[model samples]
Target: MIRKKLNLFLVSLWSVWMLQSCGNPPLVDSTDLVIYGGTSAAITAAVQAKKMGKSVIIVSPDKHLGGLTSGGLGWSDTGKKEVIGGLSREFYQRVYDKYQQENAWKWEAKSDFGNKGQGTPALDGEFKTMWIFEPHVAEEVYEEWIAELGIEVLRDEWLDRETGVTVENGKITAIRTLSGKEFKGKMFMDATYEGDLMAAAGVSYHVGREANSVYSEEWNGVQTGVYHHRHHFQVLDQPIDPYWIPGDPSSGLLPRISAEHPGIKGEGDDKVQAYCFRMCMSNHPDNRIPFPRPANYDSTQYELLVRIFDAGWDEWFDKFDLIPNRKTDTNNHGPFSSDNIGMNYDYPEASYERRKEIIQEHRDYQSGLLYFVQNDPRIPEKTQIAFKEWGLAKDEFVDNDHWPHQIYVREARRMIGTYVMTENELLQKWPTPQSVGMGSYTIDSHNIQRYVDENGHVQNEGDIGVPLPGPYEIAYGSLIPKKEECSNLVVPVAVSASHIAFGSIRMEPVFMILGQSATTAAMMALDQGIAVQDLSYTSLRERLLADGQVLTMEDRIIAK
Candidate 1:
């Protein structure tokens, strides 16, 4: 009996130990550089660090890497192709190489694709680059880079902001994820759209538009009457009613229409610009997947859309821009489309679970939108037939039922670093110093609020699209935090910029360029045993120029 009791105790102790071991997360290997977020910038940073002979790992919150680039934004929002160089240009060149193969055009012939793009030729032989491509192709390029460089990426690991981050003497020594794994590194980079790691490290950031006066800017705040693009209320010929019942004051406002008052123009607010999923769809019969009506679909939610049709504005197929292989990078065009405005005001700071709910809501909204445009009897027959020809691409996003995994987070938490980029710098009115990269895109902001105007008509506010004079240099200081906050951290995607300035700087190619620059700076800082902010600009500029980064428009020879 004594022997049996002893054996039972031993078994119990072993079981308890096994359980404890399973519950504890494995210790992540310490490295020279740790990058958070699985964005394209993250991939670029990892590759750059690896090339610089620094041990690096990408701690990604997403299972899939390449945030928007792989998430159905195939139609690149390129401004000036000449300004894109370095690894950013290399990525596009790889896409060109992929397309050069005949098998890449599975749904359509390569010759039928024709040459089409924004600022440059779709196929540039001199540069050997293609600006437009499919989502899967972009993802494949990122994966190829990872495979070639042997860069390690930890997928599906989220940072535990509450207690997971361990800061020592104003520097992040280690960061723990919600999965219990801890990554220790000498230098860190936050390349997420939400700026989660930057916030977790106690770095200061702003969530919404700052007042124009705050930055001595022109296009920063609640722009109500000042309209620059066709995305505003100007698109409507006749005033559309906001209530469920037309011209009835007793009825409540329609879904997705806010009843709150729009603030004064040029004033600051905590409201962020709208976000939507840049859907990848195809017209090819074999590659098309019929739009499945979401289980949570409610036709009543689209009451405003029906009212818009009655108003006689039928430009539905305007933004269904064709990419390659009969697929299109469909985006929001007019007043009522894919943009789920006024509903995502809380998403920037929401919890993970709340963010999931918001994402699901957006997915449902867009899915139902596709279905409604194709099947609804109220829609014009001509428009319905046009929309019916397009469906979700079967070969794209197969892992998640053909829908894009990421939503276009147009604007999110922006860091307030050592230097805040403002409109004066973007417009070239003020000389930008410590140049790192260049941004040439226009200052484009989606609608922030859709509310009832003073004249009792529904109007959208905060859609500002102003063209820039030329490409302006992005300062390296904007990527680093105040020395007292964090000495060894760099933020590329969520750089320090005012809302107007970020609108111009927040393009995907720009993010990739900045990511490479940030990695170079991090490697230099590590070698010199100094903080990122204290790194010498002369050495950094020389290295960047040697690496083929276009720091000024004068360096670019635009083919007339």
Candidate 2:
């Protein structure tokens, strides 16, 4: 009896220990660097740090690895492929290598898919790089790369924004997550879309558009009348009424149409650019999942889309960009497409719970729009038939109920670092100093708000797409915070830039490039026992060049 009682007690103790161990895992030790994001930039930064033999950890808020890159944005927005060098270029080359295998093309044959992209071949034979890919493929690359490097990634670990960061004497010592797990590090990088780490560290940043006067930028602030893209009411055959009752002033405004007067054209506002899921959709019947009606499906939410269809607009599939395996990287197209305008203005600074609500609202809005188009009797029969052909890619984002795991956060809290990149730098009006990387994509910002115009017609504002003259160098100072604000931190994803400038700089390849550059600076600073802001640009430039990073257009030309 005594022996049995002792055995039982031992078993119970072991069980309790196991439970405790599972509940509270062993804490991660202090590392050389701690990256707070699951973005492509974060992955690249980790890879660079590991390459340079630094202990690093990626505390990701996301369950998945890549932010938008693996989150359905398969059709890459690579501006100048030549300028994309280093690990960023290596990533595309790996994609190319992946396609060489017969197993990579599961849904479609490699030979059948045409080689075309935005002014470049989707499959570039000369460069041995593949620009377009599938979501799962990108995720696979990131995962395999991380695993190969043996880099540590802690997923679903959100930083405690309010009181997480422990900063002393202008440098962060550690950051605690919501789960109460503390991460200590000598250096830190905020590669998040929201710049959560940067914000928590008391770094200076901007939320929305800056006035043209503030930065002497031509394309900054509230652009009310400017409609560069087809995402405006100007595309409609006739002016649509904003009111629920056609022309009645007393009648309340229609759903999704804002009644607020859009501010002056050049004036600044707190509104940020819209966000949506870059859905990876498939038309292949065998691999497609029918669009599921959202839990909060409201038919009235898409009344404007009905009006748009009635106005002879039928280009619903305009942005269903093709990728490998008969999939599409579908983006916001028409006036009432996937871009949830004005709904995500508060996402940058919202609490974790509030952000979840916003993300769900956007998911519902986009999902309802999809279901509404295919099932609604009000939609054109032919259009409904066309829309019914495409559905969510069943194999992609399988963990998230066939929906994308990430929302395309187009713009968010941009760090105001040592040097703020403005439109002047982008347009070559003023020279950008300390070239760490380069961005050649056109300056692009999606619609901010849908409001009643001066003519009393419903229209979209803040959608600007100004073409850049050519490839321009990104300043290294943009990555480091002001020395007084924080000494050990670097922000690559949300680098210091004006709203108009961020429009051009905010691209995946650019993010990856900046990530590598930022990590190099951080690692180099660690070696010299200096702050990232104090690191010599000449030394940084030499290392970057040696690593195959194209810092200038002239370098690109020379490489060619």
Candidate 3:
């Protein structure tokens, strides 16, 4: 009996030691910080915590890091490079440093890349600028950030959002993932574009577009007269069938287009910005994957596309935006782009199975569209040949059958926090407090939904692209959920923006910038032993300046 007791005691002690070395199991009752949603912001937060001498781990459903940064937006959309300081700026600088070597471009010398830098500060052969890139290169930068931080990342571990979130005494005590593991943390950060974790935490949020009257803003919801890209009337000259019941008796609905009438020109509605996958494709013969016909291919859904081709819309072949490594950060274009506008209405609040189905539908739509454009007999010969010249990127997304892992959810679940950034704020009307960073991209929203125009023809709405007068401030308050709702959580990417305001903040570089600022907030809260909302803004602002974040473009510059 004595020997048996000794063995049991030894086993228990060994287990305890192992737990400390690796990490306490889920709900193991410990963790300095737990970040929800594995995004560019989450990674930045983990880095900041680790730097401040705290143990941190990321719980995410995605297997990859750097949400959209590494997703497919390689070419960053940096409106003003000088204003992009802090972690957001660091991401691009790192890309520049990586390519400074002769070995960076491989067979091509600096001469072959060209001189006109795409939207960003990148130099073809010229000097670096801000904006745009290939997906793989961005992924490499994110992977490097992970390596340098030594973060404990648990990928594909979903938040049991419904019952998995456990809060005690006004604090989130633990979170359970789909893998049946629980995570305990003193503080949490919601870095996802969808604001999923914040919603689960009972943080107040808003979905869909708001009325121009409510926020007293110009651009919101089904905007009519604005046409930036050729996505509207340039080609959709006639009426398309309304998806209602056939022949009479209220056929009542179309397949993808919504039945409800889209609201007035400047008024707001429940419609959300469209979503799609940011495809990563390559032209390199060795790495290129051939585009194949989708299993659920449907020809009728693309009748408009067929008509576009017939109308000499032969620009389809040249639509792809190429990135480094011969890969493309493929995006939506023309009248029928990748966005399945009305198709994803239920995604933000849908079950995992339902979400998966939506994702598959988008995949089929995009893939089948590509296949149809290249293979369908209805397409003009030049357009087909041009498309055939390109193929599915063979070398990219090697893990998931070369398909991009993420779907571009432009906007969803915006937190109705203490401070809601309205369109007036983006236009520099409100005096934001303790500003942490600045953004310059115009207020841009994609097609909110398909609707009939005043001219009685079918069309898409909410594609507003208005430029900002100048660089403006993004407040620290925007990052925190209301103090009354949840004290220890911070939301960076899905900061308190009115739906229209988010159009500008939705860029990758801007997201990275916010990620760094949020981490700074998290660290300050930890060091002071207070809720994230209660952290002293004076100190927070100072620290942000020291860390190189551009708070304001005040004639005299300030740094954190």
Best lDDT among the predictions, by candidate number: 2
lDDT of each: 0.89, 0.92, 0.75
The residue pairs that clash in candidate 1, if any, are none
Count of backbone collisions in candidate 2: 0
Please report, as a residue range, the 10-residue window in candidate 1 with the lowest summed lDDT.
22-31
Per-candidate TM-scores read: 0.95, 0.95, 0.90
Model 3 bad stretches (over 4 Å):
1-29, 106-110, 115-118, 124-131, 234-255, 317-319, 555-560
Candidate 1 overall lDDT versus native = 0.89
- 443-543 in candidate 2: lDDT tens per residue? 99999999988777789999999998999999999999999999999999999999999999999999999999999999999999999988999999999
Worst 10 residues of 3 by lDDT: 121-130
The digit string of per-residue lDDT tens for model 3 on 5-85 reads 999999998988888789665235567888888777777778777877888888888888887777777656767776877
Tens-digit lDDT track for model 1 on 418-510? 999999998889899988989899988988899998878788888888888888899999999999999999999999999889998999999
- The 10 consecutive residues of candidate 2 with the worst lDDT sum are 551-560
